[model samples]
Target: MTNDEKVRSIRSKIKCMKSTNEQGFDVIIWMRKRFLQSEAFVKNLKRIIDAGFIEKWTNYLNLQDISQRLLAREGAIKDPEIKFEEIKTIFVLLLVGHALAASVLILELWYSKRSRKY
Candidate 1:
């Protein structure tokens, strides 16, 4: 469907949902959870997001913000190898930290044993 058509569909969904009072929040929550593709739909989402703020639906607004951030970051890590390397680097750092801690404990135990013998 065209972007304009998607915008109309989204608006209609919101309108029907609005008739049920609190269901407006449900519509916003649904939109926040879905992967909206159309630019127009995204724009509509941004515009309607203010309704959540005005309604004081803090949790829903936060979810919308998180979803928006996820969408913004969706294309940032397009390379699987790059992400794998990042994970590998983090894992190596954690392993090094654990090895250092273990070595310190072993040295402390050996030192205490030597002192006791003296």
Candidate 2:
């Protein structure tokens, strides 16, 4: 289990991936498929986050302000620095990122619209 899971488990154990309908303590995953601790086994689970996902982690880890600290932090597997020479590689990365964003936005819009349709 990961640190987040350990935190949750400390808070009376949520048995993993079981979500609740509470606020502040909820992880609003929406269209985002993976989180830092998300494992490969959790494939088709939609909006996967437990009731104790946030508070449990925050308190257990003493993060206090994890959101502000980790605001847009990212790293590369091998090449940490960006090379200006690989224009095609950069373009491909941009394209993939944009496509993923567009897909998420479209999914959100469609889901919202569908909810309204009911």
Candidate 3:
């Protein structure tokens, strides 16, 4: 299949998966099992990245992360052990730090641009 067709297929699969009743860990696991970990999907992902669609993939990951966290907490109530608390906590902290670092870089870029306008 062409790269565009591959991308469309991957996106459609993701949309269908997100529409399912599964949430958080289950959704992630299912996606990994069904699509994300597949060779075809990886190839398509690399093609998309090479085609300069990084922002689209980044947005998708951000959305998936939000969905996972929102449902993960609810899932934890039913089975606390399923949450993997320590790992989740570390992952969250790392994400926060990454966001902070990105924000700082963006601010620096903005300041530099503004200074150049003077």
Poorest stretch of ten by lDDT in candidate 2: 14-23
Ranking the candidates on lDDT from highest down gives 3, 1, 2
Total backbone clashes of candidate 1, pairs 3 or more residues apart or in separate chains = 0
Q: Candidate 1, which ten residues in sequence have the lowest lDDT sum?
A: 13-22
Question: 9-108, model 1: which lDDT tens digit per residue?
Answer: 6555453223223354324333333455557555767577545643445456656666767877875534345667668989999999999999999999
TM-score of 2: 0.27
What number of clashing residue pairs does each candidate have, in the order they appear? 0, 0, 0
Q: List ranges where model 1 is wrong by over 4 Å.
A: 1-21, 24-82
Candidate 2: which stretches are off by over 4 Å? 1-85
Q: Report RMSD for candidate 2.
A: 18.6
Q: On lDDT, who's better, 1 or 2?
A: 1
Residue 20 lDDT (model 2): 33
Which numbered prediction scores highest in TM-score against the true structure?
1
lDDT, candidate 2, 46-103, per-residue tens: 1233444544554544443444345535432243675678577888899999999999
- Cα lDDT listed for each candidate: 0.61, 0.49, 0.61
| TM-score, candidate number 3 | 0.29
